[model samples]
Target: MGAAVSDTSTRTTPEHEASRTPSPPGGRSRLAALGRAVARRRLLVLLLTLVVVAIAAALGGDVAQRLSSGGFTDPKSESSKAERFLADRFKSGVPNLVLVARAPGSVDAPSASAAGRELTERVAKAPGVLSAGSYWTMPGAAPLRSRDGRSALVLVRLGGSEDDFRATAKRLVPKVGGRQGVLDVSVTGSAQVSVEIEKRSEEDLAKAEAITAPATLLILLVVFGSAVAAALPLAVGLLSVLGTFLVLRLLSAVTSVSVFSTNITTALGLGLAIDYSLFVVTRYREELASGRDVTEAIAQTVRTAGRTVLFSSVTVALSLAGLLVFPLYFLRSFAYAGMAVVALAAVGAVVVLPALLALLGRRIDAWNINRALRRLVPHRRERGPATEESGFWHWLATAVMRRPVLFALAVVAVLVTLGLPFIRASFGITDDRELPASAPAHVAAQALRDDFDSGESSALSVVLPETDADAGRVGSFAARMSALPGVFRVDAATGSYVNGRQVAQPGPAAVRFRAPGATWMSVVPSVEPYSDAGTRLVQRLRGAPGAPGTVLVGGQAALLVDTRDALAAGLPWTGLIIAGTTLVLLFLFTGSLLIPLKAVVFNLLSLSATFGAMVYVFQDGHLQWLVGDFTVTGLLDISMPVLMFCVAFGLSMDYEVFLLSRIREVYMETGDNTRAVALGLERTGRLVSAAALLFATVMAAFATSGLTLLKLLGVGLALAVIMDATVVRGLLVPAVMRLAGRANWWAPKPLRRLHERLGLKEA
Candidate 1:
């Protein structure tokens, strides 16, 4: 009876198993478990974070709208206040528009007069136009009378928002009748310039998207060696950028966020998303090769690589937060925006990405379709034991160990040489020449300079007492200012009024000075605007002879001078904050003081090389065409260096974390420095190279952008990454660590305890 029952049971078991079908336990099961875990947690965190971001976005949007509607007014610095007051009081109450007219051959009296009238009438009747006049109507306005009479000018005053004013100008241009010789009609003014900037900004954003999106996609594909895997990172990166824009749009309401910030965020988000995802995917692949079940591999990848990403993001955010030390509103806005993007990228990489990978299962590598092709690729495997003379890494280890100190010194020397140019660096605001020569604003500015004293558009405000008692004092002050070397002319109408009417003529009061050839030497001793020379000039002018009861100097130059001073004052603090914070994060991760110190020193070298290259390229006038078309104005923008420092430092750290994390991993397993460095480099070298290439492509794409500032940023950042990854990290880092040997991991007893408690675990 027992034998009969057993036979029946075996037959029944075979039938049941055949019907049910066994599930594959390789990649699919692990991915599914990972998806479940992430779905459960990510939904809650994402919803919460989205809610917070939404609220912040709404508030920011309101602020931006109010600020924009209020009109664009730069905050008053000490030097700017006086100029602001003068501009408020003396300049025409309406924004000014400039018009130029040309004839086929030569502009004769008849053509000039006809063109002037035609333009004036057209401009005056245009919407938002307050008034329009030609040289014929305003005698002694010699600047408007072209020397050759081939060109004629008309000035129009506009009312309302800049957009309204620009529309009026645009409409007026096409309406002016012209002879067969006239090629085109051009209108230029502050309002028109603003419109052009906005238009150009939109164009730049589109260009950035076009370049960054595909470049990022290509980079991910190359890194993952699989289209599906690559697409996952790209998708997350796009989401990060979209979320960032939405956040920025909202923030723009309450604060002034430059349109440039959007491009920056996009580039950063894509780069970081790719970077974080690469690390995780790489680990995930390693786990699969090691024969881990799908669920186990996914869990291990998240536990290890995901944690590293979290730490890396935190470090970058902290570095960006240091921008808060700056008083500049633009820098502050950038810092907040950048931090938000970094946080989002990190979260997306760890959360949304894992879930998606789980759904894809074995398909993560499905894109690597040729099973035979996949088999041909070498898999990561542990050698019998790490030693000084056994494998591909062993040879590299031996070579580096031979001349560590010399390599270190040579690298330092090279970096120092590159950095030398920055000591003589100078900065200025974006100049008119930054625009394309064909741009109406650029043409108008050139025309104004060539026809007038070159100072008509840029004026200085001199403050004197408003009362009659200070008339003599005011006149003396005006005279002294007029006598200054750069001063072209002085307009001090003590009793003058608009409409040619006399108001209560006060005693000689504050005047406006137009300086055409203003030099940094005359303003302050420094070669840069807002430098020591500018500050000194402000101080001297404040105490000029017959000074008003309260004299103040203000204008564009003054504002720039203030900006320079603010940057100069804040630079030390910013540097210290960035360096200190970087060290703390590095120390926390590596549990070794030496590693953090080495990273900081190496990062500084990379930064110096980048700055020196910029000075040579942008400031010193070398390779101008290769970088992009830019007017070599002999100075850099004051804010650019500060922004570069914070940004470059953070990005350099990104590479450092990537390369060093691998080295640290190898070291923990082997306790062999030489073996670890060589193996680590072998493992991460391709990824780092790929990342650098992607970054370079993204930045170089911006070379075609019309915006000079964006071009500068792109070139500078791209150069830094390439140099750091290839030269500093590839050669110097390993060489120095090889020489340091056991000392590399040395930590004091108290610190060791701390590291044990807080140190990041290896992926």
Candidate 2:
């Protein structure tokens, strides 16, 4: 609620055909039977999918309409209490729109003054306007004019939810935001910023879709070696996405889902659909190539890859579900949307894709889009530890295993160094500054910061919920607040007091400072907001000695203080839930306490790296030149890093699922840890990297976004994804496992039995 405006922004593979360990007997037969059933009833599966698609489309089209723009602040905070109380009682307790006007020369110019006055008048008359005041109209309001005399602000009060405000802003923007002769007009405020952010998010989502969709298709085609095969993953992705929209729509009835969650849902849904479908189709092809009949191949594919796909989804969905631990709907929305997409992706790939594969048979590769490209790209089978394609992964594993300490230390050093920036991360609230410089809202916000001084209007308010204080009592409290270190003035029902002295007599405007059930006062800080002096002053007021009733602090400052505390408070629990789930899932998969601990450590380390990168790149303004435009806020929003951690950890674990399943399968068969590590790398390295690349592509597409927040999410997640899939999962995992030796798969008898009974398995 900083500035009282808030905005926030899998895989499987199976293989058969290699004569290595021979497929396990017990579960394979059952999986084969299930696959045969699905294959034989392919028509029914298709029919069911059609029904789902239609239903989701019908209900989910309005999902975007249902989404909320801002809910990042904690409701438990004192600031939230004040905001809600004020909104309910005062009708327009907060200023939601600011019409900023600037003359090329100075506000002293007659023409400029006229234009500024005209702009404010037009804005005041605009639909939904509650009250508007400016230096032009409010004769003595010095804070509304720039000290330099070139600019001024028209503050507006429009009462509504963020959605309602957006509707108002949409109609009012064109009327006020356009250039007016020599005076430039721009709109920016709590509500305008939210509207701008929503608009930018929409543009960025469309752009990302336009960019990622084709790139994903091309990559899938190359990976699957045929158009038909590639299309299946795309189809699963579409189904997951549309279905997630429907899920979000269903969720809307219960709670607010931030609009920013949509980008993540679509990107993740597509990436995971592709990831899961890739595993399923590849295994199906392998089964077919192994000379199995269609029905048998489908069964074998389901037995191994299908099972692996389900496991991957669980890990990913659980990783996201961990986000539910945080109270903020912004984070929870992602968890809900991600869970739906992942569950649906798993179903599509495991249950639906198998039927399609069964029907396609050998024709799954019929289109052969990679025929010409095959000469350029060596096949996965041909590439080993010696060749270039997937061989580097093999070589890296072998190299790391040969010198575990050296590789492990080296990789750890690199990852830790990448994470170093986060140690210095100064988390702050997101403001209009997160918008690109080209945006009018951003420009207007900058103008406000540059022009306006700390004053009564710009200051924070404290509300007394059940105060029955007489005018004299209110005057005494005002005097005490005025004496605070940085408080220049205080406005209450009795009068306007400055420097602990009464300045002006109570006027009609004084009614704002009083109410029958409650009384409120504004505290004007002597120092500029967000500065050390100003922040310290705010702290003093919050702790100030005397007040009549239940006082709740509400303003940009309180929002920051409360939000920071909330994130801190919720983090340990969020971490527990996330780490706990990861531990349980990995333990079930690997049957080893050490591996799950190892996975949790590695994931946190990688998340630190991502957070550090966010701080360095976006917060520090390191890539301003390359990333288009945004002023460095010098701090990342609390929500960005927290949400990123949940999503990225899940993504990192996505690759972990693919790689570990292979490692576990091989380990169970050979009992040779080193061989299992190498073979797992050999089996999955190419696919994992490809999947990471494609996922990265989807993420990176949003890197082109004009919105700084979306850019941060995209770039930060891309960094985590690529590094986790390649460096962490590929090299470090092998090195660590190699160093651990037998301990990598070690578990006590009791836990091992639990795993045997409860663990999910693939062929």
Candidate 1: stretches off by over 4 Å: 1-36, 39-74, 83-138, 141-144, 149-185, 212-215, 369-398, 465-470, 495-540
TM-score, each model? Answer: 0.79, 0.90
TM-score of 1: 0.79
Tens-digit lDDT track of model 1 for 242-276: 67767777676566666566667767887788778
- 608 in model 2: Cα distance from truth in Å? 1.5
Weakest 10 consecutive residues of candidate 2 by summed lDDT = 1-10
Per-residue CA lDDT of candidate 2, range 656-718, in tens? Answer: 888888887776665656777787887788888888899889998888898777888888888
RMSD of each: 12.0, 7.8
Candidate that scores best on lDDT: 2
Model 1: worst 10 consecutive residues (lDDT sum): 517-526
